[model samples]
Target: MKFIKTKLLLAIMTSAIISAPFAIADDTSFNSEIKKAIADSKVGISFRARYEGVDEDGINGASDIEATALTIKSRLTLQTGDYKHWSIGLEVDNVTAVIDNYNDLTNSYNGSDSIVIDPEGTDVNQAFLQFNTQKVKLTAGRQRILHNNQRFIGGVDWRQNEQTYDGYRIQYAVNDTVSLDYSFVHNANRIFEENSKKSNNLSGAFHFANAGYKINKAHTLSAFAYVLDFNKAHAMSSNTYGLLYQGNFGAIKVNLSAATQSDAGDNPLSYDASYYNAEIATELGKITLLGGLEVLGSDKGKAAFSTPFATLHKFQGFADKFLGTGSSTGMANGVEDTYITVKTTLNDVKLAATFHDLVSNEGHIDCGTEVDLIAAYSFKKDYDLLIKFASYSANELSNDTHKLWIQVATKF
Candidate 1:
C-alpha cells in the first residue's frame, strides 16, 4: 500500500511537471497571467502566546498533581491569486515552549506532572492547490476542513498544533439555497504534533459527504454521512449518519442535531449507539442566555458513541476529564451533559460563564459538575487578550480539577 501511494504521488507530480511547459509554450498570455497572479498574492502572519496552569486531586492512592506550561505559536501563510481559476496556498506553524513544567504526553514516562498535550515542533500546516468556478470549488493536498459547529469533524484549531487532513475536497453550490460538499481523506495530522510516541496520527480511507438547504431566511437544514476506516486504529473507525437544523427566530435561536453510529473496518468491537443535542439561545437587553442538553448513548455496558475526530475540548468540560468515550476513559456507560451559558459585553470586553451537570447515560451515575469562565478583549482588531478558568467537582467519575489560562494574540 505504501508503495502504491508513493507511486501515485510521483505520477501526479511527474504529470504536472511535464504538462506545465507545453501549456505555457502554447498559450501566448501565460506570462502576463502568471505575473498578475504573483502581483495579487497575499501573505499573512499570526502569533499566540499562552500560559496555562492545572491542578488536580489524585485518584486512588496517587499524589495530587500540578503543572504549568507557557507556549507560543507562530504561523505564516501565503496564498496566490487566481490564475485561470487555479491558485495555491501554503502555511507553516511553529510552537515553542518558554516554560515547560508539564508532561506533554510525548515522552514514555510522565513522572508526577499533570498532562498538558502540547508539544514544541515545526510543521507544514497546509499546502494545497485549488480550482474555483462560478458554482464549484475543489481543493487537494493538506488542508483544513470543518463542518457545521465542528462537533463531529473539525480542525481543532483551539490547540497550538491544529488538526488538518491530507485529502481532496469538492463543493458545489446548486443554487443560492442548496449546496453539497464531499471529501476523501487519507491522513489526519493530529494536535499532538509530529514525531510523538503517542501515535497521535491516523491514516485511512475516510469519506465525508454533506448536503445543505436553506429553507428560508430564518431556517436551514443539513444532512451528512461520515465513513472512517482506520488502518491501525480500528477502534476509532465507524460510520455515522446525522441531521442538523438551525433556526433563527425574531428573538430566539435554536439548534438541533441527531446521529447514529456503528462499528466499521477491522474494528474488534461490535456496537451501535446514538447521539443527540438540542440547544436554544435568546438575548434580553444586554445579556444573552443559552441552554443545551447533549447525550452520547451507550450500547449495554460494552461500548459507547465516540467522536474521535471532533474538537473534544469544546464539548464536555474544559477540565478535560471525559476526553474520550471508550471504556478506557471510564465512559463505557456514555455521558449526558446538561449545560447553560450566560454572556454579556461590558466596556468592550467580552465576558461569558458556563455551568455543566454531567452524568452517565446508561448507569445513571453522577459524573460531575463544572463551572467555566472567560473574559476577552480585542484591541485595534489585531491584538487580543484572554483569560479563562474552569473548575470541576468530581462525583463518581474522575478527580476534582481546576485549570486557568491567560493568552495574548496578534495577527497581521
Candidate 2:
C-alpha cells in the first residue's frame, strides 16, 4: 500500500531525530527546561450532561420497552508547549450514568430494554506526542482521529464515551490549496470501555489516507481511501475509495460524493458494493431548504457496504435503526435514503426539521420513514443547551421507534 511507504518514511524521519547526537545536560538545566515547557502549556476542561429517552414498539426478538438515560461526561485536557518542535497532550475522560433505565448493549441488560448506548466508564481519551513544523506534522499514541465528515472513521462523540485509536499519523500541507493525511491504526478503542469483552473495539491494521484540494473559497474537493484488516472481527473488514466535493454558488450550495467498497484482507466474505450521495441547499430570508439522497448498494444480496467505525448516528436518521449493522438483511439488502431538511435561526436559537424516506437498495423495499427536530441555543460562550427528537414510523422493514434528547454542555 502507498501508506506503508509513507509510514516507513515517517519512521525514518523520526528515527533520524532520535538518533542525533545529544550532549548530557546537568540536572538543573534539565529541570529548568521541563518547568518552562510546563509553564507554557495549556489546559482545558469540558462537561456535558444529557437526558435521552427511547420508546420503541412492535420489534421482533427484543421486547419493546421505554428507556431513559441520564448521562454526565467530563473531560480534562492538557497540551504542553512545543519544545524543540515536539509537544505532548493528555486528555482524561469520564462518563457517569446518573440514571440508567435502558439496556446498554454491553451491560448486564444486554437486550432487555430499548437500547441506550451510553455506558458508564473512565478512560484515557487522548495521550499523544506530536512533532509539528510549518508544512508537515506527525503524531503518535492513543488519540482521537476524525477523517472528513466522520463518514468512514471518526470519534463517536455522540455517545458518552468517544472512540479513539492507537496509531501514528502524518499530515503534510503541500501548499495553500492542497493537503494530505495518512494514519496507521493498529487498534481501535470503541465506546464501550468498561465492558471490554463486549466492546466493539477491534485490533487491526487500518490505513487511512486523504488528499484535499481547494479550487477557491467556494469550492473544495477531497479523495480518500480506507483499508481495514481486522485480527478478530474479520467479517467487518473491507476497503473503500471515494471522492467528495463541496461548493457554493451564490445562495445555493451543492455536495456530491461517491465510493466503491469490496472485501479486504482477513474478511470472511467476498463482495463488492458502492455508495453515492448528493445534496443541494438554498437560502431565502432566514430559512434554508436542503435536499439529499444517499445510497448504499448491495452485492446481489450477498453483502452490503458498511462503515463500522463511522459516527453512524450522524447519517441515515437520528432514530439510529441503521447504526449498528450495514443493511436490512444483516449482510445483504443495502439501504437507500432520501431526505429533506429546513433550518433557520430565530432569537438566538437554531432550529431544524428533517424528513427521511428509506428503502432497500436491491428489491426497493420500503424500509421506513423518519422525522427529526432539533433546537439549540448557545446560552454563553462556554455553555450550550440542545433539544432533539426523532420519530421513525415503520413500513415493511423495522418497527416504529422514537427518541428524544435534552442536553447541556460547557467547555473552558
Candidate 3:
C-alpha cells in the first residue's frame, strides 16, 4: 500500500513539472483578456527534489545505522492584485517522500533506520495579507521571517516543509540609510511536521525588533532585540540584545557581531550568557579565502548562549553538531568554533569548502573537527543542481558522522 501511494505521488509530481511551461503560457495569455483579473496579480511555482543519505554510529545500542531519503517539495503561490493598498497571498506546499528508507520520526515504523528530519506531508505553507507603501510595509499571517543574517531568527528553508510563523510583521524605512523592523509572533510552526507527536509547535508572545544603518558601500551596522515568551515551552523563553557590523576594505570583508542572552518570562532558572563572532574574508583573483571564530559562552553551566530559532545548519558546522537546544538551555556547556573557508567560481559552477575546529569555552576541551564541501551549477535560467557533503571527526563530543546530498531545484 505504501509503495502504491508513493508511486502515485511521484507520477502526479512528474506531470506537474512537465505541464508547467504550458500552464504558464496559458496564464500569460489569459491575463491579457482580463486585465482586472491578473493585472497586478502574480503566481509562482517552485519545485525541489533532493536525495540525502546519513551514516551515524551508535543508535539505540546499535553499532551503526545508515539511511537514505528521496524527498520532493512542491509549492504553488497566488497573489491577488492590489486594491487600495491591500493585497492577499496564499501558498500551498507539499512534500512527498518517494524513497523512505529512513526514519522520518513521524511514521509508525521506528528504529529500523537513522533519523532523517524531512518528513513527507502536504500543508498550507503561507497565507498572508499585506499592506505596503513606499516607506512602510505591514504583513500579517503565516509567513517566513528572516532577520539580519538569519543568526538569531530565520525560516529554516533547508527542510522540506520549512519553518514558518503565524503572526504579524512590520517594517519602516526611516530614510535611505536607516530602517526599523519588528514582528509579533503568536505561534511558531516548526519543521518537524504536524504529524510528529514530538512538539512541532511553540506558542508565545514573541517580540523581535531591529534597527539598521547603512554607512556606505563598505560598511553597515545594526542593533536588534528579541523577547520570547513561550507558553507551552516556558523553559525556552529568553531575551536577547545584540549588535552587528559588516564592512569591506577594498578586497577584504569583515563581520563583527556580539550578543547577550538571559532567561525571561517565566523561565525556571535565572542565568545570563554572552556570544561573540568575528570573520574576515578576501578575494585573490577568482578564489576567496575566509577565517572566523565564534564563541557561545555559558553562565556557570546554568545557561548557554542560544539561538534556538536560528538557521543553525548554516552555522556551527554543516554537519549540524551544534544546532542548540530547542529551549533557552541551549548547550549545557559553552562552545567555541574556529573555522576557515574557501570559495571560487569556475565555468559557471560555484564551489565552497569549509573546515571547523570545535572546542569548549568553559573547560577548553577539544570537541571535534569537521569539513564541508558544496558545488552548485545553474544549467538553465530556472534550473539548478547542487551537490554537498559534510564529514565530522569526533574527539570526545558527539559522534563521527557523514552526510551527502544531491538536489535539483526549479522556479517559475
Tens-digit per-residue lDDT, 242-272, candidate 1: 9999999989999999999899999888989
What count of clashes does model 1 give?
A: 0
lDDT of 2 at 408: 98
In model 1, what are the clashing residue pairs, if there are any?
none
Model 3 pairs whose backbones collide:
236-328
Residue 380 in model 2: shift from native, Å? 2.5
lDDT of 3 by residue, 169-232 (tens): 9999999999999999987777886557556778899999999999997899999999999897
Q: Considering every candidate listed, which one attains the maximal TM-score?
A: 1
Ranked by lDDT, top first: 1, 2, 3
Model 1 regions more than 4 Å off: 1-28, 327-330
Candidate 2: lDDT of 177?
A: 100
RMSD per prediction, one decimal?
A: 3.3, 5.5, 6.8
Count backbone overlaps in model 2.
0
Model 3 residue runs over 4 Å out of place are 1-37, 59-61, 325-330
lDDT of each: 0.87, 0.84, 0.82
Write down the TM-score of every candidate: 0.93, 0.90, 0.89
